[model samples]
Target chain A: MYRYDEFDQAFVAERVTQFRDQVARRLAGELNEEQFKPLRLQNGVYLQLHAYMLRVAIPYGTLSAHQMRKLAHIARTYDKGYGHFTTRQNIQFNWPRLDDVPAILEELAEVEMHAIQTSGNCIRNVTADHFAGVAADEAADPRPYAEILRQWSSLHPEFLFLPRKFKIAVTGAAHDRAAIQFHDIGYEVKRNEAGELGFAVYIGGGQGRTPMVAKKIRDFLPEEDLLAYSEAILRVYNLHGRRDNKYKARIKILVFETGADVLKEEIEAEFTKIRASALRLPADEIRRIEAYFAPPAYAIALPGEAALAAARQADPGFDRWVASNVTGHRAAGHSIVTISLKPIGAPPGDATADQMDAVADIAARYSHDEIRVSHEQNLVLPHVATADLRSVFDALVTAGLATANAGLITDIIACPGLDYCALATARSIPVAQRISERFAETARQADIGDVKIKISGCINACGHHHAGHIGILGLEKKGEEVYQITLGGSGDETASIGDIVGRGFASDDIVDAVETIVDTYLERREGADESFLAAYRRLGATPFKKALYGAA
Target chain B: MANETARLWKDGGFRPNPWQDWPEDGALEPLDPGTDALVPLERFVADPDVFLARKGRLGVRVAAGEDVAVLAEHLENIALIALEFPSFADGRNYSAARLLRERLGYDGEIRAVGDVLSDQIALMRRCGIDAFLVTHGPTRAALQGGRIPEVRHYYQPVSGPEIEIPAGSRPWARQPAA
Candidate 1:
């Protein structure tokens, strides 16, 4: 919830003007498509399957009610009456005309938001744990450092045109909700033995055609050296990362080719040269940024526990939701509420304009005017008082935003696959819809227990299928759409890429295949208490493969 | 291709290019004795001793992915280091230019050649390339119009005359233009 100062305001305003000029140039044929592509991409405009998609950055997944309203307004006016929240914690409007994009950018700037660095081969929008400041297990709030990085990476001259697009994620909590391990660079904010704040730096992690869990290059890097160290890492990658083959261009490949130890030595040498340079974060500046995210004053001695329990008992639907969607908060009498976008039989993460407006209102009323978008494609009301849970649930239910499947089998994370993306090989949304419909029974889902089903349209893994407990990748084999399954992947504190099961299933049989795998887990689990991931880890992929492919 | 009519922009205005490219047709060829001629890095590296011993001003054109360290010790002898962009999106030259200035401390003229556009002007300047050999028609027009679209308030401290000092307590924020 950082507010924009004069300097920040000026920067965004000028960027709008610059983008306006670029658009005019492209329209007038003063620049060709080849020249205008990167320029447009930097501003987050993408030519999708049907129309130009505009992705707006939600920095660190934090938003104010006012900003959320503006996004709702954009969806209503410029695009279709809904927006798709992506796995990277950003939102994409899939139908904005090229001529309307500049105006859209101007509107975004009014709310201290812009599409800058949301795309293109640059330091992209920085993400952090959605529950950064309010999480109970947090060692430090990462928003301050994330914001510092956000400012530093925006239009950074030397890093704008890297060998490939770069993503950086930060996590302050012991639980990695940000999926930091799958990013180009991941930082875990923690306190050292002496009680000083620093980071355990992880580098060269990403998922595309290749999936990699990041390597911890530095055990502890002082918080003051954040930007300096980042610069060193980027400088090394920009100069040496592969460019001849686009597939091998990510820094992860560089880390693989050069070996992590040698690459670490090179990065360390560069860090030594610039550690005390102008990029070092001054303590006062860090404190100044931190003040913006300081916890709001909590109401003392609120009577919510008894009322919350009574409300839950009164309504089984609300009780189920409370059990699944609610999480503990650091402050007393408060809870973090996850408003599931993955409603039964719906396109996951697509929030209608009305739903957005309703969520904005709910956030203003119950969550101190703040909302967060999680990387799992869900919205979070981070500071909902336990007393207000029933009322919040009622409001969300009215807006069709209340889904009692937060971490359950039906809470799927899927991408806008062949239906929207130009790069997609097959359909992903339809498959997710089918699976959701197949498991629509709440009781059945509860019986099945926690299972993550992530679907991607192509090998790009935008849906993060690699991290799914049951990963589904949609591909075109022999000009026929086939869904491949991978099991045992998790994106949490213990991150691992899933392994592919035997052969893929056709579109017609894919839903049944997923059901078989779920049923297999239900039979194989130690008990209902044993989660799908835990069971998969304990049992490995053998039983699931047999369930899907038979014991051949 | 290297355009002979392409304008050279230095210190904020367009000027005539003093140095002519060797193999005027822009081919990879053996270097011949000449003054004020810009040759490819490969030709110069083929025989640096011979090129340094010649009686002429030397300029080396570096490809996008060429190793910049090859020019480190000879930076003093070179008058201009032209970093190629092959494509505007190929940004390896930006790193190469920064290494030339910040790492090697090569204060001599650094020129951004090939695929140079107005949109990239501000970034190239920030990376310590003070000279631009612009060929794209619209970019040349933009440069001549003195309307290079740019964001004056920068977030990173880069070496260039275009930026002032870091404003107030935020060392990351470069002050806006007066």
Candidate 2:
């Protein structure tokens, strides 16, 4: 909910003009594709398989209703009337002409948004917990710190071109909704014994061909030293990270190759020299940034428990939605409502223009004119009143945005695999669609309980299949699409990479194969109270492997 | 032996490059008076006393992987440090240039030597590389014409003076006056 000041405004506006010139130069044949590639990528334009996909950054996954409307407008005018929200909490327009990019950027700038650093080997969009300020268990709102990082990393002079793309995620809550462990650098907001705020810094975490849970480089980095410390980490990685092999270019590999202790020593040495510099954030600046993220004004009203129960009694559909979608808020009578974008048989995160507009309208009317995009490919109304939940749900129904499957089995996270991606070896969207259709019944999904089915078309793991409770990785085997299943992965506070179960199944049998695994879990669960993840933890992968591959 | 238009942009303007590239493979020799020879760091480290005895201005060339820390003690004596970008995609030199300016406070010409393209000119300049040894014809023309598209406002405080937000002006909310 941070508004861009004049400096930030001018910074984005000038970048748009600069990119406009670059686009013009490329169009006029003054610059070839090889030269123009990095320029276009830094501005979030990608040459995909079918068309050029333009990804727009939604910083810290927060947006105003006006901004959402502008996104809808852009989707309607420039793209194919739809936008896919990516796992990084950003949105992608799959179809946009090269000439229209500048125009699109201009429009985005008007709404305090741009596609800068959405792609390319640079510091990418800094993500944080979607429920930053609103979550009950939050230690602090990580948005201000994330924004500070966004400012520091945007077109950072030395880090413009890194060994590979760098990702940073911050989580302020006890629960890691931002998937901090899977990022290049993860910051967890913490308070020291003396009650002074700082960060628990984790470095080298990433998931691609190689998956790694970030290693804790610093137990507690004082909040004042955030930028300086980050600069040190980047400086170390920039100078030493492998450039010869693109696959081994991430900071994770560097930490693996050089060992964390040596990397820490180098970073500490760099930090010691630069910590006292101007990059040390002034106390006033921290306070100034924090002021922007102050909680929205709420009326001191009675809790909506009675009314919510009454409404749930009246409509079973609304009851199901409330059960799955609604989350507790710090303020009374207010609730965090997740608008599930993962509808049955649709692309995991695709929202049509009408759906976007409707959500925008609902956010303005029911919520406090604010919207949040979750890393799990869902939109969040962070401050919806529990009293207005039914109204919000009704509007969502009108736009077909209400799926009522927030953490349910059908709430899948998938990548834009062979459908639109040039890196994909197999199709991912169709696989997600098949699974969703098979478990379309609300009762069945509710019965199965919280099981995340993440799919990626290749080893890139853009779909975050490594963190799914039921991860499905699609690989091309001798020109055939084969689906490999992994069990018991999670992206929460206790993050772990899932283990692959035996041999992969053919694409035709993958859905049935997944069903057998789910059925096995249902039969073997310690009652319905235990979720799939909990059950898997208790029973381990042996049973699941046996269910999938027929008893070894 | 480069042409006149093939000049280095130093201290905010174009100036003729005085130093010639060190021979790729040859015997090391003493430099001519008043001339600068850009020698590789490895070659310089092999015999530091020999390079030190030269009468001409001294410049050290660093490859992408070489440590910039080795030049800390020699900062005052070195007139220029030319960092190589084997390809435009390899950005290790950017960090090296920044370390020279900010960390070591080396107040000499830090030139970006090889594979320097037009798009990267502004970023390299921001990282405190004051000079460029550009070989691309159009890139050189663009540098001479001052046609490099650049954004004046920056969010981060790097090697340059940051746009100061006046005290008590709510730095986060204060809009720039038109």
Candidate 3:
């Protein structure tokens, strides 16, 4: 996590005072609703469907134990005792009073966390792979670059009033756990033939009404040019992006209308003009930033157990958690652990105040004080000792954060939807809850095998349905909520937008429709090793479509 | 530099209103335009004595009779700088005020003028303005809409002069962002 210096600290504190005065002015009716709207948004406060929702940026999904504790404190004092982690890896506290929000922001500034750019038409929170530093296959930790971007974009005068909100994601490894393909700008860190590090840049990928996979504009962009190139892309979009229709304002729509080839040419020409200017990342400076994100040092030795047979024999529960929750790490004797916030039948990403404290304690205890919010809306203990896995698992279990179902069906990704979001035409969390309840049995989930189901309430796809192995998109037709299922979408190394499965399902029938598809996969899978995505790829949506509609 | 402890300027900036400084009717005689000589911003570097002597003193209060931009352009030569902010968030004056202080490096009074409100006094101070000409009263609004709450802020830098980022890794830009 990037620590705030005096400048960063004082800026936020001053902003708090500024916001407090703005609120006073608004209350006095000196500032009208129109005048107050943008200020509130820049501060990350929104008047949602139910109450004012404050979305706090967990910059690039990273949080210190202190920051997490502060969030937990806010959750307990001001908001409902729970906070919802978003797909972009930020957290939202629903039901916050507008008047109390400035005070909450003041406390947040004390811990070097604020809600700037969490909403409105501006550069948003940057995202990256949850297991960046700890991933065994990582080329480099992506968060340093992400932090740099966060600083550069925060309240940038040139970009504050963009045509639409922009999202950027970076992946440190070959696997795209960050859902890089679904963001407007995606950076894949990979080594070139000469072993120099660089990025494979993708542009215009988004998951709104027009969900499109970003086209690769630059095959290899050196790491230093990240900001300048990103600026160029944004500059082009800021100037030329359509403002006529709100739905048509995203860069994805522009890319679609202008054609990828033409867009690429324009971006390249812009890049050339700006590449050598102050924006290019000089090697020494990049190395300076890179130093901040260097992997935490571990005991210079491999894990005693190359095999997990001993752990399995010692404790069955720990064994199960290790099998499911433990992931590969780049450092020896270290393993990445995912503490599933999505406990069976609970909200997909809701972590209570106490649960937050407990997760922070465990992260500081087993790993460094470092924790990451996953795009799956879960929390990651990035560098836990393999030996301390048992202790970490026990602590997690007590917090109700332990769920040995990382890629299982019950670990569904869902947005707040109509339950909270004003833009949602339908509900997603309820659908997710229904499915989780349907498959509450651990044995049933284990049998399903690496199944991923993502649901979005509306076209925004905040739940990332477009990338789900079993994607469910909610829609409204004739004032009735309907769901359209898509098959074969995956948010991994091999990413693709799912194909729409046939006709839509009524709101009441959506749960059953999803169940029918899952049951179909279970019955028809060729072998035990074939994962849901592979099985769906082989069988196609036709069979699942037929399974649900009874005719295809 | 807002939140000046002396608390002299009630408005957000250093624009000390003549009404506040003296009597309510403390008015100055309006001056007519001299000639076609545009005030050069570099007078502080050119013969400072000559520029100062030539420009003389500017009026504490600006009227429709005087050109604010011309005085603003020669802020370096002028002993006093008073900028009128019609209303907070009507940030048009923020640019003009910032130019007077930052671009011309004016060290004298940089006050907020016209339609001044006291509530924005701290904010005006932060933007590097020195004083304000305000409508005395509670900086409260027309209606008691409600209280606005506070949370903590994460970042430190706002668009200003003091904490210039000295931004690293310049990008290739054919045009400075419009």
RMSD of each: 2.0, 2.3, 9.3
lDDT of 3 by residue, A443-475 (tens): 777788798899999988888898889889988
Q: What tens digits encode model 1's per-residue C-alpha lDDT throughout A178-255?
A: 888898999999999999999999999999999999999998999999999999999999989999899999999999
Per-residue accuracy of model 3 over B3-118 as CA lDDT, tens digit each: 32232343322322222221222347322233112222332334444434542353343331233445545554455555554434343354445435544566666655555444
Candidates 2 and 3 compared: the better one by lDDT is: 2
Please list the residue runs of candidate 1 whose C-alpha ends up more than 4 Å from where it truly belongs after superposition. Answer: B1-6, B22-34
The ten-residue window of minimal lDDT in model 1 chain A covers: A542-551
C-alpha DockQ of every model:
0.77, 0.58, 0.08
Q: What is the interface RMSD of each candidate, in Å?
A: 0.9, 2.8, 8.4
Write down the TM-score for model 1: 0.97
Query: Which of the two, 2 or 3, has more DockQ?
Result: 2
| Tens-digit lDDT track of model 2 for A1-552 | 799877778889999999999999999999899889999999999999999999999999999999999999999999999999989999999999999999999999999999999999999999999999999998899999999999888888789889999999999986899999899999999899998889999999988889888899898999999998999999999999998899999999999999999999999998999898777887888998899989888878957789899999999999999999999999999999999999999999999998899999999998899999999999999999888888899999999988989998889999999988999999999999999999999999889988999999999999999999999999999999999988889998899999888799899999999999999999999999999999999999988877776655
Best by DockQ: 1
Return the lDDT, model 3, position A210.
Answer: 84
Share of native interface contacts recovered by each model: 0.79, 0.75, 0.11
